[model samples]
Each structure stands twice: as structure tokens, then as C-alpha cells.
Target: MKIKDLFKNKEVTLSFEVFPPKTDDGYEAVEKAAARIAELKPDFMSVTYGAGGGTSKNTGNIAADLQDKYGVPVLAHLTCVSSTRDLVREVVKSYREKGIENIMALRGDIPKEGRIAFDYNHATELIYDIKSLDESFCIGGACYPEGHVECERQSEDIIHLKEKVDAGCDFLTTQMFFDNSTLYQFLYRIREKGIEVPVVPGIMPITNKRQVARSVALSGSTIPQKMKIMVDRFADDPEKLKEAGIIYASDQIIDLISNGVSHIHVYSMNKPDIAEGIMRNLSTIIR
Candidate 1:
């Protein structure tokens, strides 16, 4: 099913994301994890693409499995920054053959080695390419609630977002955010700017103390003082930290849904326990 259709449903929507493994040896374990999460029966599940081709091949395989074997609709992520046009086409064509219709198009992170030469400089270019190749595709794009780390200003970031939408993005999934107010403000700004596509907020359940620092460094999502205090208090207790993290993420989702944000996506980290905890918390609310 197209994600846009899922977004249109009256009941709030929830989805989970899982990534392909970096090496072949770990493939079975990751697939097992994906299966466990699928058992939670989220509105849909997304398979993440790796940075390079080696791991990326597994993306299609996993997405296909989720859709065909597990009977869940899949959103297959496609990254274009480090790939040539031909390579991008090949990946998209492979996905189409798998009967996967939804795609999360991304510019992807530049590798540390920094291969400067590229056929696609931005996600908008890739969105345009995907649409040109197959108009039937339901393409989703990524957005930053607190502004992109690379962009100096939130206003500039929204402008780029509008450009991406104009390039044929069907909807957007936000980068994970800790504070709800930041996303609320971003929604107001984007709506005021005339970019009205449905934006699904991404939530990450921080189960580890080290994750707090790493998440901020990666996505620039501000860690609220409340969350900070909780982390500080429970950082030493792994079980406590994990329980608190799941509750915190559930609270974030409840608030978003109460305020009429209908769709949410969780970066499940391929952890079925976290996904199940969140789903159990929302059992009455989402259905």
C-alpha cells in the first residue's frame, strides 16, 4: 500500500524502521529482528538503505520479505548522494520489480572519505529522477524538525524542503526529535510557507546513556532538560534507562496524536522489544 493512503486514514498511524545488516554473516539475525517487529503489526514498516552498494543490496531483499512474507506494506529507502544516475536507476528498478511502491528518497550522508564527484547533489534531484523514471512511485523525503545540521538557518532549511516537495516528494518523515515543541513550531512554519504534505515525525527510544550524546551529534535534535534530568538519574541503570526511554517516546507520540499529527514513524533500531513496548502503550490510542 502507498504510505499516502495510510496517512489518509482517520485513525493515527504508526510505522517502524529497520536497517539492512552491514555484512552477510549478520543478515539472518537482522531478518529475524525485522520479523519480530513485523509481528507488532505497525501501520507499515520501512527498510533502510546502507551508505554503499554492498549493504544496500540487502535493503531490497528485506523490504521484499516484509511485504511478501510478513504481509506488511514496505517503504524502501533509497540514497543517492554517493551514487551515479545509472546506479540509482538500477536500485529503483529492482525495488519496482519487488512490488514495493513507496520510497523514502534521501541525499544520504557524505562518507568521511568524501567522494566529491556525484551525479545527484541533493535529494530533490533524486526525487525528480525517480518520478521521471516511474510516476507511479509514492516517494517520501526526509525533513528536519530542528533544521538540518548542515544548514545554518531553519528558514533556509524550509526553503530547501519546499524545493524538495516541488520536485515530486509525496510526503516527508522528520528526523528524530526529542522535544515536541520544536516539531510543533516547525509544523507551523512549514504550513505557513505552503508546504502542506503530511510530515510523519520520527521518534527514537534512547535505551542507552551513550545514545543521548550520539543522537545529538548526528541529528542536532535538542535534548530537553526533562529528558536530560531523567537520563542523568537513570544512566547507570540499563533496565531503568530502557524503560524510561520507551515511556518518553510514548509520551511524545501521544502528544503528537492529541495535537492532530496523525502519522508517526519510529526508528526501531531493529529492536522488537522497544517496538512492542511503544505499541503496547498506544494500544488504545492508535486503534
Candidate 2:
């Protein structure tokens, strides 16, 4: 099923994201984790592309298995940076053969060695390539609620976002955000720019102390004062921090739904425990 269709319903949609393991030896454990999350029966699940397509085959394999074995619709991510256009075509073709209908197109993180022979500089170019290969595929793009870390201004970010939507992006999902207000303001600003595609807010459940700085550094999502207080208070206790983090994310989802943002995607971080906790908390609200 196309993720775009999932949003057409009156009730809210809740989705989860899982990533393939980096190495072959790690695949089995990740597969088991994905299976456990699938048991929650989310509206859909997305499999992330590995850096530089290092785990592309595993991405396709796991995504196919999710749909085939667990009865979940899969959105396989495809990153264009660090790859040639031919590689993108080849990956898309494999995804189609594996019964994958949705893709989250990303520009991806530049390698530590820096940009080297990248065929596409931006995600918009990748979006165009995906559409040109197969118009039937539902292509989703990423947006930043607090503006992209690289882009200096939010206004410029929105303009670039509009360009992606115009290029045939089926929907947009935000980078993980800690504060709901940031997303609310971004939604207003983007709509004013005339980019009206369905925008699903991405929520990351911060289960441990390490994820805190890494997430902030990557997305530049402002951590609210209350959230910081929670982390500071519970950071030492692993179990307590996990519980608090889940509740915090659940609150964010409930608030989004209350404000009429029906579609919410959780960056599950390949942990079924976190996904299950959030789903259990949202049982009555999402259903």
C-alpha cells in the first residue's frame, strides 16, 4: 500500500521506521526486532537506507520480508548522495521487484571523507530521478521543522521544500523534532508557501542519554526546557529514562493528533520495545 493512501482516511495514521543492520552478521537480530514491531500492526513501516547504500540489499530483503512474512506495508528509503543515477535506478528496480511501492527519498549524510563523485547534490534531483523511473511509486521527501542544519534560513528551506513537492514528491515527513510547537509553526509557514502536501511529523523517542546529543547535533532540533529537565532528572536511570522518553514522545503524538495532524511517524531506531511502548500508550487515540 502506498503511504499516501494511508493518510486519506478520516482517522489518524501512525507509522514506524526500522533500519537494516550494517553487517551481515547483524541482520538476524534486526529482523527479529522488526518482526516484534510488526506485531503492533502499525499503519505502515519504513526501512531506512544505509549510508552510501552499503546495506541496500539488506534494505530490500528486510522490506520484502516485512510485507511478505509479517503483513506490513514497507516504505524502503533510497538515498542519492554518494551514489550515481544508475545506482538509484538499479535500487528502485530491485525494490519494485520485491513488492515495495513506497520510498523515502533522501540526500543522505555526506561521508566522513566528504562528497566524492556524487551524481545528485540535493534530494530534489533524486525525487526527479525516482519519478522519471516510475511514476507509480509513491515518493516521500524529508523536511526540517526547525530548518535544515545546513540551510541558514527557514524561509530558504521552505523554498527548497516547495521545489521538491513540485518535482513529484507524494508526501513529506519531517526530521525528528523534540518540540511540537516548532512543527506547528513550520506547518503554517510551509502552507503559506503553497506546499500543501501531507506532512507527517517525525517523532524520535530518546530512550538513552547518548541519543540526546547525537540527535540534536544531526537535526539541530531544539530540545525544549521541559525535555531537558526530564533528561537531566532521569538520565542516570536507564529504565526510568526509557519510560520518560516514551511518555514524552507519546505526549507529542497525542498533541499532534489533537491539533488535527493525523499522520505521525516515529523514528523507532530499530527498537521494538520503544515502538511497542509508544503504540500501547496511543492504543485508544490512534485506533
Candidate 3:
């Protein structure tokens, strides 16, 4: 199923994001994790690419397996950070040939060891390139609700976003955010600038105490004090912390759905229990 179709239904849609393993030794375990998440029947699943080609083939294969063998729609992620124009073209061709129809175009983070390999600096450039290659693809781009940490200014960030939409991005998915008010505020700002595309909210469950700092540094997202207190209260007890994290994520999803934000995605982190537990908790509300 094309993600655009899923977005058109406008019902509360839930999806999962996973990455392919880097080596054969971990392949079976990764596939099992993918299968376990697939069993939950998320609206769709996304498999991420690597800065290295070792995982590039796995990205395509896992996407094909989930979509063809498991009877679920899959989106393969492609990045320009470490790929040339022809290389990216081949990856897009591979996905199309495999019957995968959706793609997440990104200018992925360059490796810490060196500079970017591609000419493109932003995801919008990749979106345009992908559009030229296959007009059939339902391309998705990433948005930062709190402004891209690297960009420095939110207004400057939206200007680039406008360019992306103009370049033919079908939809936009936000980088994971914690507070509902942050998203609501972002929506208001984006609408003010005429960015009316469906911005699917990304939610990450706080499964560990250390995760707070790790997430903040990775996505440059802020963790609210209230959530910090929750984590601190349950910090010493692993079981309690995990439970609290799930509830926090559930509460975040519930609030989004209640506020008429129909499209929601969970960064499941390839953990079957986290994904299943979240789905089970939201079953009644989602139904």
C-alpha cells in the first residue's frame, strides 16, 4: 500500500521504523525482529539504509521480505550523505523493481569520521532527484518540530521545508518529539507559512533513564521536566522505568489522536516487546 493511501484514510495510523543489520551473524535476529513487528500489522514499516554499502542490500531485501513475503507495505530509506547520484538511482531502481513503492528521501547524517560524499546538502535535493527517477514513488521527507538543531533558526528551517514541498515531496514526517504542545505549536507555525502537508508526528517511548540524554543529543530534541521527573522516579527500577516509558508514549499517542493528529509513528527500535506492548495498550482507543 502506498503511504499516501494510508494518509488519505485520515484514521489514526500507526507505523514502525527499523534498521537492517550490518552483518550476516545478526541477520536472522534482525529478520526475526522485523517479522515480530510485522505481525502487529502496522500501517507500514520502514527499513533504513547505511552510510556503508554493506547494509544497503539488506535494506532492499528486508523491505521486499516485509512487503512481499509478510503481506505488509514497506518503505525503503535512501540517503545522499554517502552515495553518489548514480548509486542513489540504482537503489531507487532496486526498490521499484522489487515492487516497493514508497521511499523516505533524506540527506542522512554524515559519518563522524569524514565529510559528506554526495553533492546534496539537504533532503529536498534528494527528493527532487528521486522524483526525476521515478514519478511513481510516494516520497516522504523529515521535518523537525523544534527546528533542526544544526540549522539554528526555525524560520530558516521552514524556508528550506517550503523548498522541499515545492520540489515534490508527497508528505512530511517529523523528527521524534516529546511534548504535545511542541507539536501543536509547530503545526501552527508551519500552517502560518502555508505548509499544509500532513505532518505525521513521531513518538519515541522513554524506555531507559539514560535514553533521555542519548535522544536529546541525537535528535537535538528537548525532554520536558515533567517527563524527566517520571524517569528519575523510576530510574533505579528497570521494570518500573520500562513500564513508565510505555505509558508515557501511550499517553503521547492518545493525546495526538484526541487532538485530531491522525497519523502517528513509533520508533520501535526493533524491540518486539516495546512495539507489541504499545499496540496492546492503544488497541481500544485506536479501534
TM-score of each: 0.98, 0.98, 0.97
In the range 1-287, model 1's lDDT, one tens digit per residue, is 99888787646889999999999999999999999999888889999998765677899999999999989999999998888899989999999999999999999998889865489889999999999999999999999998898999989999999999999988999999988988999999999999989999999999899999999989888999999999999999999999999999999999999999979899999999999999999978988
Question: Model 3: residues >4 Å from true position, as ranges?
Answer: none
TM-score of 1: 0.98
lDDT of 2 by residue, 1-287 (tens): 88888778646988999999999999999999999999999999999998778899999999999999989988999998888988899999999999899999999988888876569999999998988898999999999998998899889999999999999998999999888888899999999999989999999999898999999888888888998999999989999999999999999999999999989999998899999999989989988
What overall lDDT, based on C-alpha atoms, would model 1 receive against the true structure? 0.92
- Model 2 error, position 3 (Å): 1.0
Model 3, residue 96: displacement in angstroms? Answer: 0.6
> Candidate 3's residue-wise lDDT over 51-123, tens digit each?
6555888999999999987898888888887887888888989999999999988888877888647577788
Angstrom error at residue 152, model 3: 1.3
* Global CA lDDT computed for model 2: 0.92
Q: Cα lDDT of all candidates, in order?
A: 0.92, 0.92, 0.88
Give the C-alpha miss distance for residue 194 in model 3, angstroms: 1.3
